[model samples]
Target: MKLKLIAPYLTLIFAFLIISCSSDSSNETPVDPKAANNKSLGTAARDFLSAEAFTGLHVEIAYVNGFKPSATTINNLRNFFSARLNKPDGITITETVVPATTVGSLSREEYVKIEKDNRTVFNAGDELAVWIFFADQNSESDEGNSRILGTAYLNTSCIIFEKTLKDFSNRIGGANLTLLESITTQHEFGHLFGLVNLGTAMVTPHEDEQPDDAGVDKLNKHCNQEDCLMYFQTVGNAVGGVMNSLPTFDEFCLADLQANGGK
Candidate 1:
């Protein structure tokens, strides 16, 4: 199947900046009521993606023309997350059309500048910005690999391929594009919101010559285990290439939010 050919999702890379010297209380300002609530971890053993009231997370999706993503793509992604998350305030998804833009050979500086310049459509911590670059998602030789289908370190946002949003028959279709896009956003945003891995070092699969241990299988979710967004093969759990069909929340993610006072 075409879905199987799509490489499984990879963990996001986060380079945290430590502000060594600062007595600024505002910098450590308490999280907003909504964020505080999202950080709350309930004891219910129900799905991590429990239905709840809308928290009003506004998502702004921007596309660099030549990549050609559809208008309905963003909507599909929003609906998927909405069904799983209880954010009653209502989440808003908006599409920003940037004409005369080419996705070819887009650089980090170009992307970072575009994001900073479009502050009217985006807010640093509150908004989820989706940028679709004109690149091949399946290309392993991409020098700027981080520019597509992954999280950006400059501002902590999501970027994907325009090909991912196509309706090609006999190929990956439906919500698969949106699902992959959202997966990148969800995982990266999890880190920005204070979710840390249980271990200090980022987990890698079988770096040594030892046999692969079933216990170290980070792709599969198991009972009495921590299913974090940083899982090595998080995308493998989903059906087809559609990430919405997979489980969105787990104890580890919930607990991380709670520890950071997101609930």
Candidate 2:
């Protein structure tokens, strides 16, 4: 039987900036306190990491609009996640690749609308899913085009813009697109796991305390560790710096994850 699509009960928004600097801190909008306190985003991370969460978990990676990831790329992501999310009590990670298709051009709002409309394609409570869109996603603001690498809705789904990643890769001597994509995928997932000041309580004060020109907190939801995968300001040449070496969760990040029952 085909699964029915259910609209997301709660949509948690976490935005990532690809540029090294933001427009203005004053423009930074505050997240709703009520939404921040919502248990769905917070508890989802805890439940996924808990030994009793599920006997097995499935992660579906769908490539839309001509986005085709290589076999090596797919395997690398699986290996990276298995080492971290795997459990000793017979928990297993299964991955399936959805065939590539042309979904046509889409703006940021359109992409989001499509995800919400077809939410049933994802197993809702049954699976962890991420959709990678290779098409260009333009912003309505003056930032022009390709300013974000990806964004993840807590426990719901992750949307990645490959066109931007490929553009960045070409600027840097045609670097490995797969590596960049992997870094982005993992970084966004880190947010879902409640890194920094997100849902998970931080163990250390690694949060970026500096404010932007507008006086808004610069590290609202990102790590301050330059070498960690969850670090903010990972765009343009900064991406290469982070990808120069393998990205790993810093001590503070690991502490938070461990505290929440993650490996």
Error of 1 at 208 (Å): 15
For model 1, what is the alpha-carbon lDDT of residue 168? 23
Q: After superposition, how far is residue 8 of candidate 1 from its true place, in Å?
A: 10
TM-score of each: 0.49, 0.70
Task: Summing lDDT over every window of 10 consecutive residues in candidate 1, give the lowest-scoring window.
Answer: 17-26
* Best by the TM-score measure: 2
- Tally clashing residue pairs in candidate 2: 3
Q: How far out, in Å, is residue 198 in model 2?
A: 1.2
For 1-263, candidate 1 gives per-residue lDDT tens digits of 00111332334642221100101111122222222221221111121222232234555666655453444545555665565444455567666655443454444445444544442343235333223333333222233322123432322233443443332212543346545545544543443332333211122231112113344523121112324444434433332333454345465555544443344
Model 1, stretches more than 4 Å misplaced?
Answer: 1-56, 65-89, 122-148, 154-156, 164-175, 197-228, 236-244
Model 2 CA deviation exceeding 4 Å by range:
1-43, 86-108, 117-142, 235-242
